[model samples]
Structures are given as C-alpha cells and as structure tokens.
Target chain A: MPTDVIMPALGMAQESGKILRWLKSEGDAVEQGAPIMEIETDKVTVEIEAPASGTLAGLRVPEGADVPVGGVVAVILAPGEKTPPETPAGVEPMVTAQVPPPVQRTSGRGRAGRRPLASPKARRLAAERGVDVAALAGSGPHGAVLATDVESTGRGRDGSTAGVPRTPPRLGAIWQRMAERTTQSWQTAPHFYLSREVDAGRLEAWRASTRKRAGYERVTHTDLLVKLVAAALSEHPHVNAQWHEGGIVAAEEVNVGIAVAVDDGLVVPVVHAADRLELREVTARREELVEAARTGTLRPQDVGGGTFTISNLGMYGVDAFSAVLNGPQAAILAVGRIAERVVAIDGHPEVRSMSIFTVSFDHRVVDGARGARFLGTLADLVEEPAGLVP
Target chain B: MSSPSAVAAQPGTRELTLSQAVNEALAEEMRRDASVFIVGEDVAEAGTPFKVLSGLVEEFGPERVIDSPISEAGISGIGLGAAMTGMRPVVDIMFGDFMTLVMDQLVNQAAKIHYMSGGRLKAPLTIRTTLGATRRSAAQHSQSLHALVAHVPGVKVVLPATPYDAKGLFKAAIREDNPVVVFEDKMMFAVKGPVPEEEYVLPLGVADVKREGEDVTLVATSSMVYVALDAAEQLAADGVSVEIVDPRTLVPLDRETIVASARKTGRAIVIDEGHRSYGVGAELAALIAEDAFYDLDAPVRRMCAMDVPIPFSPVLEDLTVPTADTVAAEARRLVGKE
Candidate 1:
C-alpha cells in the first residue's frame, strides 16, 4: 500500500494549514526527514519532512490548498509505483481519513428513490441555506455534503466567473448544533440570573500562597472553582439534575464540562468524575483535557459526556455577568475577575479584592431557592475553600 | 488582497471584492448555520457602516442579525458572554481604532480565557474591524492595530486584502473556538472580483502573492496590498520585477511565503499603513532578518507610515501614510531606481 502523506498537525490547536509549495514534485525521490513541503499554521510556518523514503507519486492537494489536519494531501509510493486515479474535475479530492463523505448532488432528491443521507447537522444546514446538496461536489471523506461544502462559494452571482465575487464557505454542523442547543436552553429554561461579588482576595491570596504551589502543577483559581463546583454538585445533586420525560432527573456522577474557547468555536470538554478526583488530580486532569481541547485533538470521550459546566472570565477581568446555560447541562457557573472594590470589612469601608460568580441553571431542574443554596454553598466553600479541597 | 499567482492559479476564485466576499460569506454562513450569529454596531437595522451586513437581518432574522449600542466595549463584552455560553458571536468594531475601548475584553479577557482556566473554558469569538488610512478618517478612526491583537496568545488575527480571502477567512474565523480578529482594509471594500457562490474557507496564517517578479519582493498588508500592486505595475514599466506578498493573516504570519518570495527575489520591501515604530512592518522585517537573512541582497527595507499620529488634514495624512507613489519610489530606491 502506498504511504499517504497527510497534513501534519502543526500544533495541537491547528485544524488546517496552507501548502506554500511542494519541495518534492511527482516522480521526485525523497527520504524520511527530507524537507518535502512547507506548511503554514496560524502561529508558525514549518517544513514537513517526508515520513518515509519514496517517490512523490501523487499530489492529492495542490500547492496553496488549505487542508485539515490528518487529511491526506499527497501520496508517497514505492519506487516505480503508480498513483491513484484522478478525481472528477471541480470536485475536492477525498481525504483518506474516517470523516463522513462530503455531500454531493446539489439536488436534495436523488434518482432511484434515493434520499440523500446526510448528518442531521448537514441536512439542517442545507435546508436553512436552500442549497441543493446533490448539485455540488462532496469534499468530505465519503460523498457526504460536509457543512463546509454547504456554504462554499463555487459560483459567482452572475453565474459567470467574470466579475463574480468569491464568497467564503460558512460554519459547519457543529456550530449549527451548538447554536440550536443554546437557543433551546435559553427558550426553555426559566432562567433567573443571580450575580454575586466574592472576595477573590482569598482565591488570589491562596494562589499566591506557597501551600498551593508546592510542585510543577500551578493550579489556578478556576481549577479550584471546578473542583468546588464538582463537590457542590455531588453534594447537592439537584443542580446536577437534567430535564427529561416531562420531569427533572438527577445524575449520580459530577462530570463537569469546562467551556474552552478555541479558534473557531467553543468546545466544552468534560472532566469526568470531577467530584471523585482530589485537587491535584483535578489540576492534572484539567490540564490534559484543556491541551486536547485547544489542539483540537480532543477524543470523543474527552468532549462527548458532561453533566455540569464552569466558565471563568475572571483572569480577563470581566467584572460581572451571567452566562447562557449550555443546553442539557443542568447548570453553568460563570466566574469573573478578581477586582479590588470598596466593601464593608469589619463594619468599615475598605478596599478588598472581590471576584464575581454567576451560575445560570436550567430552572426547570432546580428552583431559585435551590440554585441560591448551591451558589451559597459554593460561596461559603470558595471563601474558605480549605474544607472542600482536603 | 488580490494576488497575481492566486489570480492566475485559480483565476476562477479571485474575482470578488474583499468586502463583497465578506458580505457573501457572512450571509452564506448565517443562512447555512443558525448557530453562527453576527452582532456589531450598525450590522443589523442599519446594515453596517460599510454596508457589508446589508440584508443580513432580513435573511437571518434579528435573532442572528444583532445590532448593538455604539459602545465597542459593551458589544465586545456581549460577544464574549454569548461566546462563552455556547454561541459563536462575530462582532464588527466599526473602526480598528475603536478597538482600544474593548482591548481589555479582547486582549486580556477574550484572549486568555481558555489557557488561564487550564483548559476548562473556551471563548469562540470573532471581532471584525476596519483598518486603513486613505479614507481620511483621520488619526483616531484610521489605524492598523492588528499588531496589538496579534501580541495576544489566544487570539488569531486575519487581515484580508481581496474578496476571496475576506469571505473564506471570515468563514474560518466564525468557526474558530479562540477569539479571532479580522482586519478589513477600508480601501479594498470596492475592489470587486469573482468569488465562488459555494462554500470555501481560506485557512488562517497563509499568505498569497498577488504579483510575482524577480528583482525585489514587496510585502504589504490590507490597503497597502493594493498600493504594492500599483507599485509593481509602475515598476514593471521600468523593467524592475517586484514580487508583491500579502500576509493575509498577520498573527500566523506566513514566514514561508515571505521567505520563499524573498529567497527567490533576493530583496524584500515591507509596505504597511501603520506608524513605523514596532508596527507589522517591523515584525515582518525582523522575521525576514532572522530566517531569510542569507537570502537578502540588501537590508530588508520597510516602507511604512511616518512615526506621527494620523492628521485630520488630508495633505498631512497623505504625507504620513504610504501611497502608490511612495511605494514605487521606495521600491525603485531599493532596486536602485534613482
């Protein structure tokens, strides 16, 4: 079998890279570690070496094409071996990866009473854009109209290449699903937001305290908050409850999703069984999950399951605000920056560092009283926080 | 921006004007994915100051078509909030200069939200802002502040000079989970070309060569791309072959493209609209010096705006920023024009 030279993951966060040029063209012999091509990521441009010694048999993606990570862009065949057959013109060459096929056939209906099978996200995108999936070529793995294909600007407005503007393709199915989920959460949940200003002085003070920084792992206040929320959710399982079958149901495990901002969209990867892990384990686990999330190397198991979530904007110094509850998760806790504000300290006006914590919950699962109790418990624990960690 | 090679290589994909392409991409993305929403000043009811968001409100509905208060800070904060809670919000900050009001949210807050949380949270946000000097928008309103955002770790910055890139890059930015700031040059808004009606994404961090020649390389950004193109045309008349390089996305600055072009040409001149001190020109020049130093025939020449604030007067501003004439003059000088 010919060895495929796929687009290398330049950085864990990089999804795609541009092919500046092919150092080795078709029929050119190469060796492993030989500079084969130049790839540019969002932050750095590095040369990718040939994975193995072989002749450049075929260029799956042309010079200047932007290909996703793990997507095959070229083929390195054994000496004198033949390249694969040419793909149909105007269609994107298929990547050998396991991604579902790109949807083709611009017409929604196909011959022989065939209904074009597409991902629910892709179908929804097609319907919303009025795009006939059958009419276009599928760039995805198998002949599926990938969400990227649905928004591709293949033709100009005048139906002619002349004077026509190239429109960029739109968001994919993942973004569409995220939007729908948030919309559903906002629409369904009787959301009553309560914002509180906590004394971040203690959180910050603890972070500075030598006791917290005993090793290589530097646990942030956000990490502590995740642990605190997990403990709180485990203790008060009501907040970890989910809405189902016309009634509220609670879960036993506290799998908390940490909302991480990536280049394209937010991905909340779950810290499975957060309540069970000690603070040190929680810190290490959070690091591993975050590394995977930002690099887009997150496995299905890394992101797929979650029961509660935490979002911290405090480091960015957001004074205070409410977050939209990511749907299905019973509650989402928003943490704001630790700012020094004048408050009554020992019955006297004093400037003390404070951080705001806002929790947006699915009101159907937990009432205001219960929600307040959760926040109150969180506040009590966070203010001291020593009890929960030990 | 328009590149001769990109135009030549894919003559079919280079026709749309940058702004037209942005509008088309936004419209297409919004239409296709209900999850992608645009919230910016004058984006909805007012159709956008640059008219890029025209008819978006009617098409995507007000829920996705959000018009906000004149507060850049407030709107940016709102974009952050919406992004954190699950929605991908694309914000337009009217002018690049006004981004200062919200830098706290963008540079400090939006940029570091993910890493600081040790991977527990992410902010998928895109801020679209305008940068150029020729519109006579004057000192405060017209500035290329992409360098500021580029300095932030979590934020990805993309600057588009052509319609082809604007649309594709915008689509990519909307899909990114980290905060992305796209710098749209005011002058390139009307430079129309052919853009495919179908979906395509121009990945971030890639550079496109608008024109190719041998003697010298002209690396430009935004409106300066057009200026460099004009300079290339003028130099062609003089038999001096100048290669024009557009580093489309400045943060993921395409060092390979710049180095390749520089190595091929042996000389490079960076043209930008920002003030000369530590601007994008400085960064590009530094990279070339560090990586492609052996490839240079002469020291890398960076032709940028003078170290002075943008003036309200047209004549003063004219003298302050780079013009096609100055670019040609500088290119000619570097290539021994005088």
Candidate 2:
C-alpha cells in the first residue's frame, strides 16, 4: 500500500512552512522517522521526518519554496511500485490543503484524495481540491504523492468536475474547520453583539497607586481584566456555556483561553481555573503563553479545552474590534485600548477614561441577557477589584 | 587578562583597516586557489571601490583579475553564470546601495538556483561590497544593507568586522558551494589586525566573541563590532562587563552562540548598521526574547541606524549610523544604567 507523506505543521498556528534545507537527495534510500528536510515557519526551523521507508523519488518544490500546510513536497515510492499515476495537465498545486474528511467519501471521480506526492498535507490536498486521488500517481516516499504532480497533471483538485471549482483553493486543516464552524455558527445562531464602554477611572488610579507603592513593578491592565473576568464568569456561569447537539453543557471549571496573535495565526492558551488563581499568576501564565506562541513552541496542552476566552488588541493601539468565537468556548471577550472621553459625571460634562469590551458569543448557548450581564459584572469587578480577593 | 591564549585571542592586534584585510583575503584566496577569479567594477585594474582589491591585478594575470563595464547587474550575472560553469568568481559590487539594482539576480537567481534546481547547480560566487558612511557617500553608496541579502533564502551574507575573520571568512566563501555576499565596513577596512599566514577557512554562520563579560550580551555585526567592543571596555570601567559577539554570517545565523551569550549576560542589546525599523537588530531582539525570556531582566535594546536613508551631510550621516556613544548608551539601557 502507498503511504502518503503530508506536510507536517511546524507550530500550532502554522498553516505552511518554507523548505530551508533538504537532507536527502534523489535515489537516496530513507527510513521512516528519518529527518529528510528542514522547514522554517514563523522564524523557527523544524526538521520534517520521513513517513515510510523507500527510495527518494521526487521533490516537488525546491528548498526555499514556501508551501502551505497539507501541501506535498516530495514522494517516496513503495518498493516495486511502478508507473506513478499520471497527473491532469495544467493544474497548479495549492499552497495549502483542506482538512481531511473523517472518512474517505468516494466521489464518483477515481482521482479523489490523491494530491501529488509531496507531503502528507498535499495528499489531503487532492481530496480537498476534489481531484481524483486514485488516478493521480504519487511521486513521493513509499509511493506517496507530491503537490507538483497535481500541478503537472493539470487537473484541479476536484478532478475535472464542473462547479466543483477549478480555481485551486489554499486551505489548511484549521482554516477549513474555522471557516466551516464560523459560517455554520453565523448562519444558524442569532448572534447579537453587545459592546460596553466602561469607565476605568478608578481602576487606572488604583493601578497607578499600586505601581508607586510597589516600587516600579507594575502589572498590565490585561492582568487586572483577567481577574475581573474570572470573577464575572463565576457570577454568570451561564455565559460560559457551550452548545452541544442535545443541550447546553455548562463547564464546571473556568478555563479561560487567552487568544495571542502570532506571526502566523491565533493560538489561545487556556489558564485553567482562572477564578482560583491570583493576579500575579494570571500575568505569569499569560506571559509564558505569549512567549511560547511567539517562538512556535506551544505544547498541545496550551491550545486545548476552554470554557471562556479573552483577546486584547489594546497594545497595538486598536480602538475596538470583534473576534471570531473559538468554538467550544461560548463567549470571546475582545478588549480595546483605554482613552479619555467626555461623560456626564454629576450631570456635568467631565473627562473620564473608558475602554471598550466587545463580547462575541455562540448565540445558541449564550443569550444576549447572559452576555450583557457577564460584561456588566466584569465592568463592576474592574471598577472595584478589591472585591476579587476571596 | 588571565592566560596567554586569552590575551592572544583579542580582536584588535593591528591597525589594518577592513579594506586591507579584505584585499589580503582576496589576494590570498586567489593565490591559493587557481580557480578563484575577481570580477565587478574597478575590481581588476581599478582596484576596488574601497581599494580592497588594489594589488590583485598586479599579482595575478588579467584573465583571473579581469575588469568589466560599469554594470552592477551585469557583474553579478556574469559571476553567477561563471560560478554555475564551475569557476569561483569573486565580484566586487562597489557599493552596498548599488546591490539594490541586482536584487533579482542576487535574491532570485543566485540564491534560489541551487535550491530550486534541487542542488543540481552550484554557484560558488563571492560578492564583496563596501558598507557604511565613509566621507558620506549618502543614500547612493554608503549604506549597511546586510539585511537585504540576509533575508534572501540561499545566499550566505558575511559581515566580517576584524582582519582575521575577513581573511578566514572570505576564503571560506570562495570555497563554499553556495553564493556568498561579503559586506565590509568602509571605515573598518583600515582598522587592521594580525591575520595568520597559514591556510584557514572560518565556517560561515558562526559568531566570534571579541570580549567576554557578565553584565550584558552585546551582539553587533560588521563595523558595529568595534563600536560594541569599545562600549564593552567603557562599560567595564563602570563596573559593567559587556560580552561582545559578532555573527560572521547572517543566513545560517548561529543561534546557539547568541542564545548562550544572552543566557550568560541575562541582558542583551543588538547593534546593526541597518535601519532600526524591522532590521536585523529586531530579529536578534526577538530571538533573545524568545530563547532567554526568563533570563532577561529588561527588554532587549537595539542600536541601529535611524529609520532614514543615509544623508549626504557628515553630521546627519554620523547621526544616522549607530556610533560608539549610541552603542554604549544602548548597552547601559540593556543593563538599566540609562
């Protein structure tokens, strides 16, 4: 049986990588798990291991070529394998591959699932492009395919099916899932956005006093907000609910996933039971996550399972913006920068500092009233953070 | 300060300028390897833009030291073609600013050909260009454009500071199978050091520690190397010892050396001649923050040229490029002294 070598995602958010070095040469016999190539994505270099033991057949993209996630690069034909599948002429290879379906759906076209013999991602790519995988011969390791084979064959991933789309799509596993889930959520759920501009006057004064008292060792506003959110979520557990097929599954623990923007994409590292941790602990955890994300070294534990989430673009000077709800998490709170604005204080126009927080929720689970109450409670806690202590 | 070996390893042993060392390296490499030839403007009979290739034509025959028409694009193209044809051609592109004209040839052709062709074609070409403000060549000629070449995929960019590295690294570039761009500071060429007479090939993508200290790690490339070393000395006087590192090649950047230094010092400041905006200094700052986050006591400070083109006026040009004073100030800032 031919084994497919897909593009290995270097980091959690990396959809693709540039081939920096090729360790193996054509005709060189390679073993499974052997380092065959070095790829650089998001400034970090990672070695790509060979999948199946076989003689190196072909390299689709040369070193230094930027390929999308799930796109194939090389092929290792299975021993005794002959006549690599012929590609449809004139089809260009996609930079990225779509997420593989849970099960192979045999679309009448015999070419489904066979992207050229490049990497594992490339193989999944054939199916995503709707190319006939079976008809396309792989030119990679252990009879695996490559992306160029698809390009060389000239057939779109959908395998000459009209309305299946001839224009090649560059989609990765996460992107495919993100798009599907986002579109589905938007279409079905009645998403109502509730944005509140809260006066952070007292909080700012408190933070300033704390910094002076602590001798220049100051904590960021995000740290204080995380504490406030944790307390608020505890008060309004209804907003922290997730939508399931049968019913709403309200999570028992508060695992607040903090969304960090890296060079590639978004990676949310969850702080488990944020309600139980101190402000210092939250700051330290967030710092560690940001570092890990920036360096492309985030562990699997850093990305999985969250009941609530927070994304801050305040540091980048962004005034206000909405964020896509990271599925499974019912609500994602977006925080913007604090600026001075005119407000009615004691029935007179007074300058007060305020910051906007926009909350996007899975309307199926979190109702507008629930989200509003959560934000209102969060605003109160930030104004009076002393109440956050147990 | 302690041992003879340690004392002998110090970067400055002679007053030879950066140009003199480059000339020595070129002459020595050409003499040692008959396959080595010199190309580019004024490189053969006219010497070099900085006179780094002055005596090569007199020593070697015109075939090995042939001059070409004034075309920066043509110079690199010929070098790349000849390198592909199996000749080690060292091209002097005169100015770092002029290299912009041949970006396609350098970045697309020279850098990608070997990798794109899957190692079928080898381009053993050396591009020697002068970088930095010397008598204010302005935006056209005087500029440290290492970042441009370093960002390219296959090309190895060598910005050697000392005479020893200039000789050793240049020889290494000539022998390397890939194309290399040797960026030398016009001012540093006159600053000499004692280079060994024996054959040596200092591998690219490695860093050299000019001075070792415990307070902060100072990483500077090319001419900024001397400024960093000088800052270290000044810092040492004030009870702050700065460890200075020069990454000889930027492409296969030696992360190990940089990270180790950062770890030791607990604070880091990167100095580069490139502009401060998204320059090599930014890359180094990110690298240190990523690897040595816990070790860092403060944010990494970068001393680079102001985000402006090198001006024609001497005062403006001097201010634009990172000076010794600026390097020292950044060093102090890294350690929280400023």
lDDT at position B56, candidate 2: 81
Candidate 1 residue A8 Cα shift, in angstroms, is 71
Tens-digit lDDT track for model 1 on B260-334? Answer: 998777678998887788888899998887777655545688888788878889888888888778888877766
Distance from true location, Cα of A261 in model 2, Å: 50
Candidate 2 chain B minimal-lDDT segment of 10 residues: B1-10
Output DockQ, candidate 2: 0.01
What's the lDDT of the predicted structure labeled candidate 2?
0.73
Error of 2 at A269 (Å): 46
Local accuracy of candidate 1 as per-residue lDDT tens digits, A1-390: 677887887565567776657788767899988989877544334578898888875565554445777776667878766765641112243332222333233221211123444433345556665566655455433454444455463433334332211332344334544676778888887777766777776666666662445662578776777888887887798889888888888887789998888766677878889888877787788899888767656755677558988888776768777888877777888988887789997899999888888998787888888999989888877787776644
RMSD of each: 34.4, 26.0
- Lowest summed lDDT over 10 consecutive residues: which window, candidate 1 chain A? A104-113
Which residue runs does candidate 2 get wrong by more than 4 Å? A1-390, B1-16
